[model samples]
Target: MTQNRRWRRVLIALFVVVIAFTGYHAVRTVSDAIYWNAHRDEPIERWMTIGYVAHSYHVPPHVLHQALNLPPMPDRRPLGRIARESGRSMNQIEAKLKYAIVHARPPYPAPGPPPRPFMPSPSSSSPAK
Candidate 1:
């Protein structure tokens, strides 16, 4: 009976820990979603990387690279580093990113009518009477 009680206590503790862990993450996820949604249109900054800017501003990374005349790749470097390496000012980089964001096309084309379902044509053979 004592062993069973100890096992029960252990299971209860484990269950509590699991619940706490899940609750913490759930709260964090909701808070982050709210924060990002609120700041979705925030301006890009020099400290941000290409991927970060792309995600924050809803602009494609390729558009940003094209605007900045950089090779198409996953550039992990921050904008400040990129500007410094390319001998350009931060303002120039910011301007190019802004332009690209302003002119960036929608990632997907406009939805069109649903495709018609395929139907086999009626056979030329007559049905037996």
Candidate 2:
């Protein structure tokens, strides 16, 4: 009977912890979403991540990373943090990236004619004497 009671207590404790953790995350996500939605009309902050800026402006993530000279990483950190770590002024980086977006260029020039595949000579195809 004691063992059963202890198991029941452990299960209850686990359930409570799970509920608390889930509830905290749910509330945080909703609040953060609301805050960003309200700030949509404002200029993006330096503390905003590159991904956020790119998404807001309809820019491709990879293109933005290339423009900013940033390496591909799992998590996109804020541009402010990036500027500080790279010892560059935020304005400089922002200017270059914004200009790149405005003056976006194609990665390649106009396509040229496809090369023709080489074919074996007719003489050689005669079972090579």
Candidate 3:
């Protein structure tokens, strides 16, 4: 009887430990997700960083990634390698790129269609010159 009780106690302890672990992980995941959603910014930061490097070097993504020191940000695939190789920091590259694009956008074209005065057609009532 004692042995059976001890085994049962061990099983219960193991079950409790597993339940506790599972609950902890579940709570952690939920909290992390909530935080991420709350703080997430819409614009993708990694691409912006990589794009900055590309603009600076006048090269493709592979070449840029072949050049800076950027963290492993998702969507920065080929460019990350270039940036790390080139020793250019991702933050600096991103800043420069953002500034350039924002400043470079052309102003809206003149509001309305071109102004053309109406002229009577020669085909209707007017005689051909």
Pick the TM-score winner: 1
> lDDT score, residue 36, model 1?
80
Q: Report every candidate's CA lDDT.
A: 0.89, 0.77, 0.57
Error of 1 at 81 (Å): 0.8
For every candidate, C-alpha RMSD to the true structure in Å: 7.4, 12.4, 14.9
Candidates ranked, most accurate by lDDT first = 1, 2, 3
Per-residue C-alpha lDDT of model 1 across residues 1-129, encoded as one tens digit per residue: 999999999999999999999999999999999988886767778789988888888878999999999999999999999999999999999998888888895566789999999876677455757
lDDT string, candidate 3, 7-90, tens digits? 999999999999999999999999988875653223435444555444443444443333333343424454344446657665
TM-score of each: 0.76, 0.48, 0.40
Stretches of candidate 3 off by over 4 Å are: 42-92, 96-129
How far is 67's C-alpha from truth in model 2 (Å)?
A: 1.1
Better of 2 and 3 by TM-score: 2
Name the better of 1 and 3 by lDDT. Answer: 1
Clashes of each: 0, 0, 12
Span of ten consecutive residues with least summed lDDT in model 3: 63-72
Please give the range of 10 consecutive residues that has the lowest summed lDDT in model 2: 36-45
What lDDT score is found at residue 105 in candidate 2? 44
Native RMSD of candidate 3 (Å) = 14.9
